[model samples]
Target chain A: MSGREEILGRVREALSVPSHAGVKAVSGEGVRDVRKARGFLPDGGATPEARLKKFRKLAAKLKAEVEVLPDLAAAGAFLADLAKTEGWRQIASHRNDLTNSVLTSLKVPILWTDDEPGTADLEQVEAGVTSCEALIAQTGSVFVTGKGCGGRALSVLPPHHVVIATLDQLLPDMLAAFDLLRERYGDNPPSFVSFITGASRTGDIERILVLGAHGPKRLTILIVGN
Target chain B: MTSDTPAHQFQEDSAVSTADFEHRQWMQDALHGYENTRGGTEAMFGDFEQARQTAAAIKWEAIENLDTLLGEFADKLEARGTRVFWAGNGKEAVDYILGVCKEHGAKNIIKSKCMTTEEIHLNPALEAAGMQVVESDLGEYIVQLREEPPFHFVFPAMHLKRDRISQIFEEKLGTEPSSDPEELTMIARRVMRQKYCEADIGISGANFAVADSGMISITENEGNARLTTSLPKVHIAVLGIEKVVPKLEDLSVMLQMLGTAGTGQWLTAYNSMIGGPRQPGEVDGPEEFHVVLLDNHRTKLLADPEQRDALRCIRCGACLNVCPIFKNIGGHNYGTTYQGPIGSVITPHLRGLQSYKHLSFSSSLCGACSETCPVKIDLHHHLMRNRRNAVQEKGGKMERWMFGQFAKVMTHPKRYRGSEGLMRFGAKLWLPFKGRKLDPLKAWTASRDLPAPAPKSFMKQWQAQEREQEEGKS
Candidate 1:
């Protein structure tokens, strides 16, 4: 017998579950609806202003720099200032629409990668910039999909990562983030989706907190008010 | 690796572990740090009990429908171009991975932190097949360099001091000796960065497998898992069949519970949900994705209704952190890949009751483990059940005889009163030699002094008080 058949047979025998047991197929909408009705997700903040406040506070606590800007132009200006202060000669960025618009106004040298970035290209770059899919307020996590900057490499390979997001993308919690994902992607989701809480960190060595382990050391989120 | 000989070795292992004062001191400090951070986690989730209960229900629903859910997950993953392999045991799983390596002519491999791989001893097998395997997790790498098993679940090298780690790095990697953890971490990062880019195959263990989307979610504080999957030409995920949830929505609750219960974080630094290989437009990811579903002895645990809840473990190590015996004895004493309360309950069934039954009796039965369990598994009760089953299977001749005599005397009031006097007389005779090795009381007296019995039995004192009360009334 095939290993799959044998294993499945064993599972049925072990659980004493009938072979014809009717397992309900859960749809994306059904999951969202049920989770919404359950109300188990913790409340981040009641108002958008309250959420923004909580987001900024929690993001800072995780050691991520949070700057709330009035518009994309303001965000561009902040990035330009940050680049000058950090002495970044070139920044690796995804060639997405939002990133293009933001970089067009900034005078920083932008290195755009439309394909898989070579290790040399990623290692040489000082910073990476990407537009996030959503921002979770409760955990201060920025949700990025495979379609974001350089797929997964740009967000992790560089020493510095800057996420440019609009205020409207902020959600109360992970559950709401999933709800928005289902609403946007339907059945065909990206190959990779990451919820980056902070810059790369490791407490593996005697539980000492050290940043910049394989991923960006500094995570800066520039939130533009809609 | 097997529990057959562990019952006899447990005493020696525990003695060695406890005798190391330096290790014990390090463990105490680490435990304190974990508890302090855990307090912050509890505050982050205001109603942790409600969250735990909801998480438990989700696990229960998923496990009950394991057959259907696993089938659906396999089908969906196959549809997404991920080759799903079902392995009946660890050997089968290892052989299949080796076969894949040969097919691709892969030589070097990089692996993330995976307890399942440790449980199956996967690395040595791969190495024996002429492959160089590098462990990327900082703690795992330290233990790997020392040629030792993980001392703790989450903190693999919790027993080692920073100075010792410095020595290991100096010896193994020929780096300058440094006691600073940050410097040590940077040294490892420098070494492992090349391995990730050079590896032919990357392997990982799934934290949760969303059956609805056929995606594997891996949570880690470091980005090693992300690099392990993204850089390799072929990515293989070895998962125990039990690590499946029914839907993606369930992940929201599971991740919350796991983050708090495991490392006391609101969310780990990275939570990646990976599906198949690179998609049509994706620029980076594995060209080939393979999922190995392992069912080594898990089916046996699933068959038993009384102990099946043991499979509900997400391996958060919360129980180990809270266990008093584990704190004193340490994880290596358990002599199993999985250790502490959950290990004691499942080791007998996974390895065999005859050899591992002693672990069930090793606990203090304080019920702290059950209370701290995120899934609300009745862990202590399961240990008790193992003890009962062990005794029923093979009655202990001395224990049965002694308990039988006590039962006879306790049922008869006159015999009990007579024995009470005899016990007082016996204690007076035996108390002098209690400190001697040959004395029967040697085990009990070695660590503590025996408390002196009351001058008079409670029954006689109670009767005398009643008589005095009656005389005073008259």
Candidate 2:
């Protein structure tokens, strides 16, 4: 017998349950009910304003910069000023409409990572900016799917990452974020989904916090008020 | 490294580790830091007890229907173009990986930190096949350089000083010696970044496998797992069969509990869920994705109803951090891929009771491990059961005989009084050789001073006081 067959058989015998039990048990439930069953809301009040405030506070604690801009134009201006201050010559970004507008306003040399740039090209870019699927307030996490981020390397390879998102993307907690994902994607989800809480970090060496370990060292979030 | 049996080796290994002053100090400092921050992070969960119960229920339901859940997971993954392989043991798992490597003509492999791989002993086999394998996690990298097993579960190089790490980097990588941790992290990062780009195969272990979505969730503080998966053309994830969860939504509870309980983080820096190979429009990620579900004695563990709860572990390493015995002896003393309370309960079942029964006896029967467990597995009770089973199997003749004698004397007052007289006489005879090595007292007084026995029994003293009161009243 194949290893798969043997393993499944052993599992069935060990648990003393027949095959296809789980499928039978879960057929009646809808995704909404499943979401409600394990709905875990963070301690902060569940409102857009409250979530945004909590997100800013938690993001700051994680050493990430957060700016709540008035509009897309203000976000663009903020990015432009940030680029000048941080001395970034070129910024890599995806082909999203919002990302395009911000990059166009900055007037800096742009590397379109949507075209799948090489590792050497990605290394040369000082920073990368992209829009996210959702921003979790409780943990200060940005949810990025493979389709939304163009590719994983754009967010990981650059030394600095600047995310441009609107207030509508904020969720109360991880459960709400997963609910949003299920509502949007249905059964056919993206190949890769990541909940990036902060810039890359490690405390492996004598338990000392060090940032920028094989990923971005600095993360700046531009939250445009919708 | 010792020729002694596992039972004897455990005593010797623990003795050596317990006496190492520097190692003990390092463990104390690390555990204190963990204790200070863990409570605050766990408090962020808001109704953490409810969350724990929810997590436990999800795991229990999934394990009860593991056959169906695993089948659903495999089907969904295969439908998404992921190849699923099931291995009954470590050899089968290793053969499948080597076969894949040979098929692709791969020369170099990079791996993220995974305890399952360590359980299977995968590295030496890959190196024996003439492939250059590198461990991407900084902690794992340090221990890899030293050719030693991880000193702790989460903190692989927890026993080493910063200067020792600097020296290892200088000798191995020919880099400048620096004691700064930030510089040390960057040095390892600089070296590993090139390896990520150059490697042909990338491997990882899943923190959780979502059955409904057929996705593998990997949580890490470093971005190495992310880089390891995205850079290579072929990505392989080796997971234990018990890592499965029934629904994708259940991930929220497990992830929250895991982050807080493991490293005292509200959430880890990165939590990645990979469903299959890169989609058509995606520019990065592996071209081929493989998921190997390994049983490796897990089915045997599941068959016993009393011990099946051991499979609910999320590999958070919290129990190890809070365990008093683990703090004293350190991680490497366990002489296994897994260490501490959870390791003690499950290792005997995974490996066998005969070889690993001593691990069950090594504990102080402290319930600290169970109290700290996010899933509430009744770990201390499981250790007691192991002891019961071990004695039942091995038949401890000497212990039984001694306990029988004590029970006989305690049950009868006449014999008990007779023994009290004998003990008073024996105490005087053995008082001179208290510090010397002797049969019964040797083990007790090896490092301690035994208190002298009372001159008279407690019962006799009570009777004397009663007689004095009666005479005074008359």
Candidate 3:
């Protein structure tokens, strides 16, 4: 018999003896109700201000550069000032409402993701600037998708990663982020859905923290809000 | 030495490791740092113990209905144009991966950290097939360059100091010695930049397989996995059959707990879910995506309900961090793909009871493993239970025989009195040889003095007391 048949047969035989101590499993669709279990997870705050405050707090702890600007105009000014200080020659980004509004302020050469940019060229750029789907407050994570956030590699390949997001994009926690994903693209989801938490890091050598192992070393999130 | 058994190998290696105070201190210091950070991070949870219960229940649900969830996971993956292969053992899994490499005429392969691949010894097989495999994770890469298996499952090169790591790089890569972690990381990052672009296939291991969403989730502190999957034309994920969870949203509960428990972070740097090859409109990803489901004695573990909960292991290394035995003996001494308390409990079932039962017996039965386990496997009890199972299976004959003799002497009054006298005589005679080479209690007495046995038996003393009382009454 094939591996599938033999393995399934073995599993069926093994599970015949009922041993679960009354852990009720939702039959049919087989997706157990997780709403109750989510309560056990760290609670994101109830109000928007509390969530925003929590996001900044976590971002600071992770050593990520989080700038909460009053509006997009102020964000653009901040980016322009950052561009000058970092001495950036070019920025890699994909065209979107967020990117379109902010690109003019950088006043630097742009490497567009949609233009079929070479991988080597993408590597040499100063930073990859993209718009994220949501900013998760509970873990201080940015949710990105292949189709939405300039494909899979753009946000990760460059040395520095800059995420431009609006206040409305901030979600309370991971569950809300997952719910937003299901609502946006349920059946035919994007090929890659990622939660980018803080900068790329490693503690592999004598358990010492080293930033920018293979991905971006610096992750700057600009949240434009009131 | 003539025995040449794994049990003997474990003993010899353990002796070497435990005596090396420098090595033991390194392990203890690393774990001490882990404990302090993990304590605070765990407190960030709304209810840490409650979170553990929920994680355990979800894993329990996943394992109990393994067949259905696995089928659903496969069906959904296949629906999205991903090829699915089932391998009953490690050899089959390796064969399937080799066939994929051959079909693509692959040259260089880039791999992220995957303990499942290590479990199957995938790299050696691939290299023997003439494919160059480069480990991308910093620790795995360091250990790979040193031509050794990972020292710890998570911290693959945890045993090596920075100077030692620099020495390895100098010997292998003709690079200058540098002790700074940032410089060493840059050295690897610089070297692998071209390999990711040139590699034909990328192999990864999934932390959880979401059956409902047809996606496999990978958690990593570094972005090696992200680059591995994104750049390569063919992405293959090999996961154990027991990794299946019911829904994608279940990650909402599992991911944060995994990050905190595994590395003492609120969350790891990147958590990615890949459902299939790149879609029609998507800009980049692998052209072909393959998912290999490996059973490899997991069904044997599942068949025994008493030990079945062990399959819920998330490979978080939390149990290892808390285990006193692991800290003392270290990882390589266990001689298994996994090490520490979890390895001891499950190795007997995964490998064989008679051969690996020594691992189970080596533990101090402190129950620290059970308490530290996030998925809540009864680890210490399982270790004890493995002892019973090993004996019942006609193993541990020497122990059983000795106990049988003990039971016989205790049952008869004459034999008890006679043996008691003999023991006292023996104790007196044994005093000179206590810590000598000829001593039976030499191993115990070598470190410290053993309390001397009483000069007279309890029965004789009691009889004398009764005689004196009778005289007093008269």
Error of 2 at B90 (Å): 0.5
DockQ of each: 0.45, 0.47, 0.60
Model 3 misplaced regions, further than 4 Å: A20-33, B411-415, B440-451, B457-474
lDDT by residue (B247-365, candidate 1, tens digit) is 88888888878888888887899999988898888887888999999999999988887667677889899899988888888888888988899989988987899789888899899
DockQ, cand. 2? 0.47
Q: Which consecutive 10 residues in model 3 chain B have the weakest lDDT in total?
A: B451-460
Candidate 3 collision pairs: none
lDDT of 3 by residue, A82-186 (tens): 889999998899988888888776789998888867777888899899999999988899999998999999999999999999998999999999999999997
Candidate 1 regions with alpha-carbon error over 4 angstroms: A17-40, A105-111, B1-4, B19-22, B421-432, B451-456, B461-474
| Candidate number of the best DockQ | 3
Docking level of model 1: acceptable
* lDDT score at residue B134, model 1, on the 0-100 scale: 92
The true-versus-predicted C-alpha distance at residue B463 of model 2, in Å, is 0.8
Write one digit per residue (lDDT tens) for candidate 2, span A1-226. Answer: 3999999998888878333322212222332233443444245446888888899888998999999888999998998888889898888889988897777778789888777878777778999898899899878999998877768777787889889898888887788878888998898888899999999999988788999987889998988885
Give the candidates in order of DockQ, highest first.
Answer: 3, 2, 1
